[model samples]
Target chain A: MNITQLPFIKEIYGFLGHDLVAAVIGILIILVFVPLNSAFLVWVERKVAGHIQLRPGPMEVGPHGILQTLIDAVKLMSKEMITPKLADKFLFWLAPIVIIIPAIVCFVVIPFSPLMQVREMNVGILLIFSFSSLTVLSILMAGWASNNKYALIGAVRAVAQNVAYEIPLLLSTMSIIIMTNSFKMSEITAAQSPVWFIVYQPVAAIIFFISTTAETNRAPFDLVEAESELVSGFHTEYTGMRFALFFLAEYTNMFIAASMGAVLFFGGWHGPFFPGLIWFVVKVYALIFVIIWVRWTFPRLRFDQLMNFAWKVMIPVALLNLMITAIVLKAL
Target chain B: MIAITDIISPVLVARGAFWLMVTITLTGALLAVVPRNIVHNILGLALAMFGITGIYLYLGSQFVAMMQLLIYVGAICMTYIFAIMLSPPLELELPKRRKAKVITAFFVSLVTFIVMAQMILSYKWAPVTSLSRDWSIETIGQQLLTRYFLVFELISLLLAIAIIGAIMIAGLVRRKN
Candidate 1:
């Protein structure tokens, strides 16, 4: 539709108008995509898990269980809402909302295609991280509000694991920011024409991927929701749609993390063939597949082991990667 | 139908959206700290931080925004949750609000927000006249190595020390068990 040629562009260029219409349109796009994408991710995860276990997944639902997620979602919608007797009702109800808000908001700065960004701000990467942290807060709120011992333990483990991994995540990102100079995703993509940053800073990319997996609470880092031990983790007491929100946030976060990996390590939306958006989706889904693969392949790490890995191994490697990148860039 | 021209300018609309985001952030911050329930407070903090991330995007720092989501949403909030989980006593009673302390903190935060807002409103932010428009990742890399080499090196050293310290403290805690 030649969005660049839209009248909104001229107004933005003139610096005399507000792109309210465009902004609303952008927000609507995110609202639609998030729920839809999350639903699909659920189906994908189940199918992947089923295949790994050699079991038929969602065979009863439409066409090889394609409609299973939708049916489950509807069932959840109809189920009774339950609040624990000792729980703080207000915060308990509020937790899921908080978790979902950041998931939706972080997409504001994510550039889907060259012309399809909501807000092509200078600090897109930072915005995503800042908002994404709220999910953790929501997780904490969920655990606290549940008033369950297991939920509390799960929340504690989740937080510690998150904190331990965060340093390396930020450091690896810094290495990229140092390499790119610009915090803007658009600029970072543009900088990688002949060679992607993955080639220049392979170590940072590896650290980034690992840290992000931990960051998103995916396995082997899914200690928070470790089914065998913590039961259901932070959202243990949650039921119905409230429980679904947390589920939605997790999958959404997974998608966002994968998209970030695509944007950072792979040449986000950059390829020789097909459209930019297609390339972007391909890279993102490819990364998502790897995440699922890792999830099914590895046994969950103990909470202590998870924390130690981040503090001891990933952080040092990330720092060293940054240092080497700096030296190489200098020597050149 | 109303003409598209009747609506506010896109830039002004953007500003309005920005103000809306700011309001959401500030209000969320207030809610986060003032709520009697610690959990409510944390949610409020998350909302407020999300708002801040929006502001960062407005300020042209996407990397920082993503980092905000990754670290704060992914890490810090998780830590707060961990604290919540570990401290069982916190669930026994609602955290009592000290009126005097609340009043004082409110005044202080209000004053700070006002002063900061005033300063921002007052300042004439001049664009860097001769700076390259190329805000590419390569430029950041080049600058980090050539111009900001000391800072880069220091950051690495700082990260190294942080790792050692975190491990030592965590290990000590584990050993005490």
Candidate 2:
């Protein structure tokens, strides 16, 4: 049976398929943006790390080391992808793609400019949060499939770390959600026209930023990949292109976390004497810079310290912040 | 269950992408049961949940769809997989009585499917008004607090009572020790 020829199904698709082209175009833009943004961020992270330690980073690669990432990408792609003899081939291959997929899909809801959102849903924030959690599963799969002790240990840490941090992450965001009375990225941004949510929910903002940084597995939350202990954690067995895919996803996730924080706390794309997209980009990069700075300035927390901080410190503070926000909103 | 069928049957009738989601869901269930490996079974359950998230999207509420993903796939599935990773999988086989039970189960499900299909085929579906139906999060929130206020509060009260009872039991155990 030719299903597409079915009259009823055809009618329904006909009714709602008008946006198909536009949606494809939007996805294409995101596809192009993900890699470029990741590469640029990696270059910036290196440059930032270099200057912090008093050295010129990647200056030999190109003028000001701008083309360093491009060369690195080429080097990564050309390298042989080695699969461990004992590795579960199915899960090992699936992990990288699975990790990357949701990170790309998350771009659909993010508003780059007023007119530049891919697909705006009432539950855009939830969509991102939910998929972000899926990355934890991917990390576990990669670690377990590698059949390596270090990899499994790394993956285990990732799951525990993500599960603990996700509470404060959601709680902090809930405070902002209450203030705006909406979860749509556009609405969350628009609600901040008069004053940024950071002004009203500063505590929530701090927790949100910290939790998001942890969510992306950036330092001082990079215990998932704590080089000293786990030897690159869950990705110890990956090689070449497969490793690059994980890197690509990691950097892209860092941007998503930063941009989402911008949308929540900073007035996204809202600034004087500049376009919305420019303001949005500027805010994102600025946050990324701070994240990188924190990475260098701070040391990674131990496993117990990370868990206690999330449960005892971050969760309680975030809950208190939420209660206060709700009470104030009610009284006002 | 009957009311759910009434809601889903109309969307099910539009069988283009709907069928794709259905196939995915069936495949996921099959993977969950047919796999000898426990990890594969867990992942199959996750895949089925993912397919359900798509179906929820098709049913016109992105909120419900994301919540399905967030709660079921994200939290519950993660917990299951994590525990599975920690514990060893069982490999004991059942006795020959399983054949009879499988046959009976198949017949029961087949009869149920027939009855449900008959009901669906007999019913007249109303035209979808997705475009004209303009509802917001605010409206849903208001309805929950006003119309379903008792149910909402009662559920919260139930959770609170459960938590306190658990704590009370723990306190008694500690005191005895």
iRMS of each prediction in angstroms? 9.4, 10.0
Interface RMS for model 1:
9.4
Q: What is the TM-score of each candidate against the true structure?
A: 0.75, 0.85
lDDT of 2 by residue, A235-328 (tens): 9999999999999999999999999999999999898899999999999999999999999989998889889899999999999999998998
- Model 2, B36-137: lDDT tens per residue? 677778788889999998787765667778889988888888777667765653435633457787889889989999999999989996565344444456
TM-score of B-chain for each predicted structure, in order = 0.67, 0.60
Expressed between 0 and 1, the share of native interface contacts present in candidate 2 is: 0.37
How would you encode candidate 1's per-residue C-alpha lDDT over A1-332 as one tens digit per residue?
22233332344544434667788799898999987898898898889989998997778889989888999989999999999898888879888998899899888878788988888766678777766766666777788778898897887776777778778988898888878877788998888878888987788888999999998989998889888988989999999999999999998999899888888889898899788999999999889989998999999887668778888899888888889889988998
Best by lDDT: 2
Residue B8's lDDT within candidate 2 is 42
Runs in model 2 with CA error above 4 Å?
Answer: A1-22, B1-13, B89-136, B146-177
Q: Tens-digit lDDT track for model 1 on B10-44?
A: 55655575798899899998887766666667667
Runs of candidate 1 exceeding 4 Å displacement: A1-21, B1-88, B91-177
Each prediction's DockQ against the real complex: 0.29, 0.26
Error of 2 at B125 (Å): 7.5
Question: Per the 3 Å backbone cut-off, how many clashing residue pairs does candidate 2 have?
Answer: 0
